[model samples]
Target: MGVLPLVHALVPNSVGNLGSLLETVLPWAGLAVPFALLAALRRRSASAAVAAGVAAVLWLGAFWPVVAAGAAADEPNLTVVTHNVGAENADPAGTARTLLAAGPDLVALEEITDDALPAYRKALDKALPHSVRIGTVALWSRHPLTDTRRVVLDPGWSRSLRAEVRTPGGTVAVYVVHLPSVRVGLFGFGTAARDRNIQELDRVLAQERQDKVLLLGDLNGSAADRSLAPLVRRLKPVQDAVGGGFGLSWPAAFPLTRLDHVLGRGVVAVESWTLGGTGSDHLPVAARVRV
Candidate 1:
């Protein structure tokens, strides 16, 4: 039982959503290890000692940064936020208004369809003067936007885009994305599409030469999810550096996970937080960064 948590962490998950789901509750599972060991020791079990040692290594190995705080930065150069506005968002207008109210230097929205684009544009026109979209994702900026184009991530459609925003500090490359969603059941957390998308996105990011780059939108996975390691290896999540608890942003009513994120490369995080619930299922995430 004690080695179970460590086994899950080290071994690749083959079952549906097994590994990913385990990540969501791994902390709690680890928390149980010590108590379980205590009970075993009280029973004078020698195996308890060995299990205790294994649990310690597993907990530390997987969550050391979380307990210690990650590489968050200070004194930001700009602020940005991201959200995956559910397609059926009951109140798109209200969600748009709520997001603009945060006054981030930039905002990225995902899961936006052609039909709802107008409402978002109208609601944000006055606040976000410059905006662009590719497929279902879009970016609004306060600075000059240039070199905007579609990033052909998947076949027959574009779920991502890139734009160069000339901020007061310097030129920053911004990529707005809504990676493919994962499915459960017999398919077993089908992530082939999302993984392929990440590979392409990582390639673009790797080739990018900008001093600072920001990836804002719904990644459909958490920073700890192994499938996202390709991007995580290249970019550091701002909230990781600037801690505020788990900062989960999905399912606004009772967020249990952080599918939305503000990731940065080269820049530094000043602070990060989740906004109050909007009409969308996702709670908006904001971050301040120094480019």
Candidate 2:
């Protein structure tokens, strides 16, 4: 029991990497191997078999609901848009125009450059009305903003921000984050920065008091990866709720994994989908949720 909490706390920071492993084999690791060993050891003992069965059920039950709930499609909604415009993007104006055309109630952008801000601001100013920008991440909304501040993902990197938007339904706290990218080299995968970002995000989520929350940005890892488990444990992806497949959003030419996402809490996702190719490396992901 003591170790369980420790493991749970560490899970999110490792979720991005673990997701693929879990989806492919981890679920069966516990039930198949351990239960099999117990069965063989106990032989035909009815008591041992029952105990093993109970344990298997309990273990599966704990994670099944979370996975299943994310898979379900529910109604009522808030339209949200998330995108990574790439610091050296080709055309900020065109990208911003495309996003505005989608009619998102709230927009979160990552990898924004100082030079590109003006173009984006001009493109979205009229439609969005209220906005907040902190370093490379920004949030724009149609509703009034109460509080906006930078969320530190790393000691020196100010690539995340949190904003409180007052809407008709209620005040919703939205966090826009851009985590450090992990790279695979001859040596291996570099995950130090990514891991630290996840830990910081976890800390922020834990302290958040708003009942309704939305997390958006370039997480630099997939939902299936274990490194994102911490955030996954607390939030539900819009894609998981309404997307058709993986909802790939990276590399406009050929997207295989979804790196951009919109996660919600105390909100219902009605529909979610990826938008057309943008000038940036990542395609825009949008979701309509019932607040």
Candidate 3:
């Protein structure tokens, strides 16, 4: 029983890659696996087996990372904000105003439509002088952007993109992604498409040579999900840096689970938090990092 906490904490951070449905179930399953192994090894009593199973399940699903805070940093800072403004978002002006007020050095937006683009452009034009938009995902920055290119996450879907921003501190490769959403059914979690998207993203992240990388998106799954392992393995989640909790982001009104995130690699997080309502289904997430 004492070793359970240690086992739970040491498990590689693969759980976040599992997507949404599997996100909830796999950890619980992971917890039970150890107990089942113990039962087989010791031929333990039924009650002992049940108790071990429960402990493992709890440790995997609710503890560990939940208690781990983001890494500390000491250097120049860059503030970034990410939000998935719903496709049919009505208050583009208000959302833009709110985000601009945050004074982020970089901003990534997803689910942008032609109709709302103009309003957003007008609203952010003064603060964010440089910008790039591909399909529905876009990046706006206070600094110049170089080596900008549309990252082909899926030949079938033309929405994600990657760009290198030239900040005073250094060049940071930023990827703005809107992964496919997953669905739940009687049998179990269904995430074939989301998994494929993650694989494509994995290839992109693997090939990156830049020292600093920032991934901002509506991942549709929390760090606890396993399907996002490809990205999670390489990048550190911002929420885990500056402690406050999960920073739940979906269903802005009463967020219970974190769906949007700001992940970084070769960069240190200074602070991270959820932005207030954006008139969309998701609440925006922002992070300050030292590059």
Best by TM-score: 1
Lowest summed lDDT window (length 10), candidate 2: 1-10
Worst-scoring 10-residue span by lDDT in model 3: 17-26
Higher-ranked by lDDT: 1 or 2 = 1
**Superposed model 1: Cα runs more than 4 Å off:** 1-8, 14-17, 28-64, 67-73
Candidate 2 total steric clashes: 24
Cα TM-score of candidate 1: 0.85
Best by lDDT: 1
* Model 1 per-residue lDDT tens digits across residues 94-172: 8888888788889899989888888989988777799998888999888889999998788766778899999988899
Question: Each model's TM-score?
Answer: 0.85, 0.76, 0.80
Which segments of candidate 2 are over 4 A away from where they belong?
A: 1-77
lDDT of 2 at 17: 42
> What clash count goes with each model?
5, 24, 16
Could you tell me how far off, in angstroms, the CA of residue 31 lies in candidate 1 after the best superposition? 5.7
Per-prediction CA RMSD (Å): 3.2, 7.7, 6.4
